[model samples]
Target: MKVAALLIADPEGPDPCRLVHGAPLLRHAVAGLLASGCADRLVVAVPKSALGDCEVIIRAVPGAGSRCRVLACGADRAESARLALDAAGESADVVLVHDVARPFVPPATVRAVAEAVLAGAEAIVPVLPVTDTVKLVSGGVIESTSDRDRLRVVQTPVGYRPDVLGKVCARGSDPLSDLPGSVRTVAGHPTALRLTTAFDVAVAEALLEEQG
Candidate 1:
């Protein structure tokens, strides 16, 4: 199955170091993708404005020099993915969408999500079971406490059958803040570590160091 690690060379968020500044682990994100080894092809989505920087990055990253393609990433996640799906073509049996900033998206995780998609699951998403007590508050008062067992924090490489993803996007932007069930099913949680803050980056660095 062909796989794409649909990542934004520069994510919209403001933590920086999208590897744009040449952090030691920036290229390591591509290395993570190479671990998949299963993707018949690899592509990196960069802002149309950053092609030159992307070119330099690819050339600098050893094995990635000839393996990745640059596509236009849109303002939103779904749009960026739409561009990727279009590039994957009609024969792409399963598509794996992941974040580059995570850098820790394990190849095993990619393979697991892909396997779930190939297994005829309409949508495959990795989700961590909620570990904290959830509470609902309206204004200043607590309304109700949510059951932890009934909830999950979904993570990516949210995989999908090409058609299913198309259908969800066709409905226009997702209405809910949280991922809705209508879009997919849980594919089992993998090492989906998100990097949004300095602490997160630190955690990711430790995870990478351990992998070494």
Candidate 2:
């Protein structure tokens, strides 16, 4: 199965996913994906203005430069996804949309997703079970508590059949809210934590240290 991973990078970086441990979050993600040896193709989607910089960084990676492709992204996630999908072409059997913010996705998780796709699953999303209580609030007023058991916090490297994801992106549908078909889930690891805020980075760093 020819699988491709679409790595989304922050446009205005050096902040959220900045130079953590002297490497940009996007670079770290590329290295992790390459080490997995899962993706036949790795496409780094970055801001149009930042494409050159990202390309430079990707080329610097040992094996990524030859196989990986760099794309100029749009302003938002959906647009960026669309761009990546377009660049992926019709060759890849399955496509994975991964967020660079979640830099430490384990190779096992990536392999699991690929295996699922090869097993005929349409859409596969890795998720970590919700640990804390979740509630629906209205303007600071507590509404009703959501069932935690049914809740699975979604993580990326979300995999889909090339055509399926392409159609979704064509419709500009919000996959998070309106996925076209049935979606399957696999267990996620703590190392896949997304680094959105500074605290998240700290937590990810701690997780990495623990893993070491």
CA lDDT, every prediction?
Answer: 0.63, 0.80
**Model 2 deviation from the true structure expressed as Cα RMSD, one decimal place:** 2.0
Candidate 2 — what's its lDDT?
A: 0.80
TM-scores, in order shown?
A: 0.81, 0.92
Pick out the ten consecutive residues of candidate 1 with the lowest summed lDDT.
13-22
lDDT of 1 by residue, 18-62 (tens): 642236334656666677675655666666776666656666766
lDDT of 2 at 60: 80
TM-score of 1: 0.81
Q: Backbone clashes in each candidate structure, one number apiece?
A: 1, 0
Q: After superposition, how far is residue 137 of candidate 2 from its true place, in Å?
A: 2.3
